[model samples]
Target: MDPRQLARSSVPRSLPEARHLRQDDRFLLVTSIMPKNPAAVAHGPMLIGVTINVLLMGVIVMQAYEYFTSYKRRDDRYLKSLVVFVFCANILNTGFAVADVYLALINHFGDVQYLTVSTWLFVTDPVIVGTVACSVQMFFAWRVQVLTGRWYLGLLTASLALGQLICAMLMAWKCHQYPAWADFVKFTDLIIAWMTTTILVDVTITIILVWYLRRHKTGLEGTDQVVDRLIRLTVQTGMLTSVWALLDLVLFLTQPTDASHLIFQIPMVKMYTNSLMSSLNSRPKPKVFSEVTDNIHSIAKFVNHRTTMQDGTMQFASSLHPEAAAHLERHELGEFQKKTIEAASSGCKGDAKTGWDNAARAI
Candidate 1:
């Protein structure tokens, strides 16, 4: 009469009993339909995902610091916009990690009593991926907008992002409708990645064209120099990101689940490498760079002062003018010349045939 006794007394399905076995299969299929169990959360896949998010967050923090310290007014906009895109993208990924953790904690299953058990995956995964994809596209659009001040290209980015978002939503919808929509997940992930990569590239090229047009129109040497450098930097970074993205897409799309892990490893390594490289690039070595620059400036100022005095470019027309002697005396410089003067006074500096003057001779 006890419930436990009743459950124990129930007939077990034999392998030959198709209907009973079906029922058994449906019951035991919990593992198949399940998203993740708490124990599963401790596995390698979850660890890898967590590591990725933490690493990405580290890079974001480093870049955010770089952005704050970057003093150049022009570079601020592009750099900050890109940083924002990266920041948001990383956040979206972190959100996915959290969702996965929750799913794992709950031991996600399609046929669970609670409808939310599987529906959460349908709603969350696509949204995270979609936001990141569209945000990256917009980041490129922002770059193009600044370079050309053009609206049309930005509009194109917006349109493409909107379309991707819609597809992402549909991907979720289909999954929600049919619990076995594995293809929906694959399709949605691949499409967004492909579109994101394509649009970013296209928008970048459009930006380059705009820069070329502007540079050619105006004979602006100074502006041209900076833009040329920007083009090179962007291309270098973009190429690296594209390479990683392509590898990820190929692995995710073409490989079977078990084999996919190996293929995906390449991209994961690339991602970590990129984070390191990007951090190095963005980090300001202020002491080294600034000290070197200062030394160069000092040397340049020394050379110019000497040249101007020697050539009378910084001289007096008449001895009656006090400022001329004062200016000349300024060019003469300081006591650090002791060694050079001593060497010259000792007749050990500069060969006469070389036509170079010693500090002793000048003084």
Candidate 2:
């Protein structure tokens, strides 16, 4: 008769049939309610990267604290200022990164159109990263010159550092021009150049430092040990940044559409700052040489020398023989003095007597 009665008649009459129909409806509803966005492919990696970046920032803060507190009086003013500038830059970059993700995922939730494009905050990452990388690289370049006395090596390193910064800035501009994440592929050449220069600078610095240290190694165990430690630190810090940059490039090239590269890219800046801090903090402590100084003083009795203490500074004088002064000058002790002064200027603090002993034994 009526349409309503006819529709009711079509329903399953048995309890088992009705239960199956209910289960089918439930399955359909669940499937329809599932999110359609490719969140796992695009956003998951970003969240993970940000988390890691924050963790590393904590480490940087701790290192910065140690540097400031322990080396405040000893470190040069310019070097301390550099650390402060780098630390501030890192904080700014991290803030920009957090804002970038927050605006896209949290603030604009369910807005698929907004997530497709990056904001200005997202582009600041490259600029800030470039700044920090250039600063640290240039510092190392100066170190290279100081250690090797070759201006060309320092100039080459500085040039490469500047090149990478230029590439990074260009990449940032390109990102600003094409805000859509999909269009990042358009700047493939820029990405390649930027990462390539970064790796080149790192490798160049590492080679120069390691070569100089190895060449200057003295036969004495104490001096050679110092040189070996420097070599190891140089390799570890330099290769770490290079390998990470290479990995970021590889991931971007291989999976251009996916956001997997963000994982390495976000944390890359921290690696530079950490490496610099590690190098600055690795200098030998004065307390480590107390026993060595005692032994050295005991041996000094046999050499017929006079030591004068003035203003808390020890001065070794050849009072018994004027020829001893000429003999010391003939031994090229100036080179050793230059190195010691360089170390002190670079914020490395150590016992003066111990350094003298090491230098004398090497000679």
Candidate 3:
């Protein structure tokens, strides 16, 4: 064969073959550069949702335990009704959350669009969670007011709580109106305001409680122990909730496409309710300290004679031990009778008789 003939044949006579190879190269480049839905940041929220539901279940169990053990015995008709309302709201919240998971993942597994599309299940979440949050915060505001005898604290906290609740409701309404998960980022300002207000309210409550408890500290050893306990409890509960809210806000702002915010948002109601129940139930039971020491009588008298003043529509008490005063104001006088009894009881449990006697003498 001639050299020219070989060159001409080798030049590739088919134009379509050259175009197909070029297209294949382009396809490979695009596929390599662009992220696939499954491999990219898709499952972050789905996995978070599952974990959140598990935690929510635990919260409900704890709520039930607290209610049966303490609230049932401690609350009157009105208070018990409030407990019932909160519990019922939690049930609804959990139901809707599970439904959201089902719709977004289990029911429409392969459908990527469903994940970013807001449905009725997602729309109702803010309403349910916001209502629960508002009720709990307002309750805390009233309690803090009673504890500190400061009407302004309650008013301020309640105002923030109301603001957050309103923002949440408005956010939810926007979700319903737009009906797209992607559209939610458009209301980022409202979401930030909602989270910021809740965080402020929580931190403010913590500061007020801790400040009041510290201010009222009697130099007495037993009284100091009780005050320390109150301060620790307030800090732990208040900080945990506020920190979770902060984390949610951070994730929402940084990873708007990921539903990682749900992780912190889901169990917040449980935090509030559990904090309330713990505050109520942790007041030493009378029988638990009945045999401990004679200091109980003096503490009992102090709690019984807690200072009271009428302020507008509310009547509250003020005392060196504000926790005791809060119990008294709520008509939980039996629980109040042993406010420092646990401290006294612990003090009396020393191995040496002299230690018990010294503890008794100190009290």
Candidate 4:
């Protein structure tokens, strides 16, 4: 009783003094409640993800600039429009990511409650990613049909792509419904389906295209060299996205308590857009025509000499002319080679140019 009465009597009576004490107590309460290292799990990954996303955005800008400057007249209108669409979508995705990070870590600094909740910006990521991926996959599917002349294969690829897109949209809607980060596990099935389909579509496209390109080798040194290069590129570009997607899925499943998966998810759409641009930009130029001309001369020589019989009789033997035999027996001369032969025989440089243009697109 005596000690309590003494303490109460010593308390500050001025309003300013009491207000200062209240502020000090408030500061102590905040420090006590705050986690020792909130950034490790929540803000740090987002910051790193956003940083990488921005770097990729810069790369995309450079690639887009190059595409427009170098292929302005060379690319068809549809291709040009696709480039524009992907570029715009990437910009939108990056913008939302930046905003999401800024709002959580900057505007609401030290707000633990705010950091624990998901926002609309967070939901946009899956939607934009699905759109860009589907567009690229559909483009490849159309190419598969054009190159392989197998409509059913293309349809299968397109179907997988569409399934992934639907899953992505559903996942986004579920994420929106569950704005709490802790509740993300509720939609784990959707995430699994989306990432699984993404991986499948990427692998399927890679395998189908690689198989077709390998089969496309004409045995001629020059043409086979081109096909080999295409095969390497298809493997590299296709596996890149698939590998990253797998990593993202693995991290999401293993580190369910953290946002580490965002590291790969943030820059995913950029990878797709860059892969497409790289493919378009890497198309063989007029310089390749010289090699094609050399190939044509070699073929002509082989056809002329090999088709002549040993008895001085000119007899066309299918065995001696593999290209023609492929054209006749197997009908396996791909669109690119068929066009190349027709253009060369017709002596139309314009058609030859068209054939060369179709070569990379056929991949």
Who wins the lDDT comparison?
Answer: 4
Runs of candidate 4 exceeding 4 Å displacement: 1-39, 286-342, 347-363
- Give lDDT tens digits, candidate 3, residues 207-297: 9878877888655556567678778888987888789889989988998765567777766666666666666556554454433343334
lDDT of 1 by residue, 257-361 (tens): 322332232223224234323533443244444432332233323333333233322321221111111112112223324433343334323332121133322
RMSD of each: 14.5, 11.3, 11.2, 8.7
The better candidate by lDDT, 3 or 4, is: 4
Top candidate on TM-score is 4
Local distance difference test, per candidate?
Answer: 0.43, 0.72, 0.64, 0.73
Residue 305, candidate 1: alpha-carbon lDDT: 38
lDDT of 4 by residue, 253-303 (tens): 999887789898888998889778777766544445455455545555554
Q: TM-score: which is higher, 1 or 3?
A: 3
Give model 1's TM-score versus the native structure.
0.47
Give all TM-scores, in the order shown. Answer: 0.47, 0.74, 0.73, 0.77
Show model 2 residue runs off by greater than 4 Å: 1-38, 286-363
Clash tally, candidates in order? 0, 0, 0, 0
lDDT of 2: 0.72
After superposition, candidate 3 runs with Cα above 4 Å error: 1-43, 289-295, 298-363
- The alpha-carbon deviation from the true structure for residue 233 of candidate 1, after best TM-score superposition, in angstroms, is 2.3
Q: Model 3 shows how many backbone clashes?
A: 0
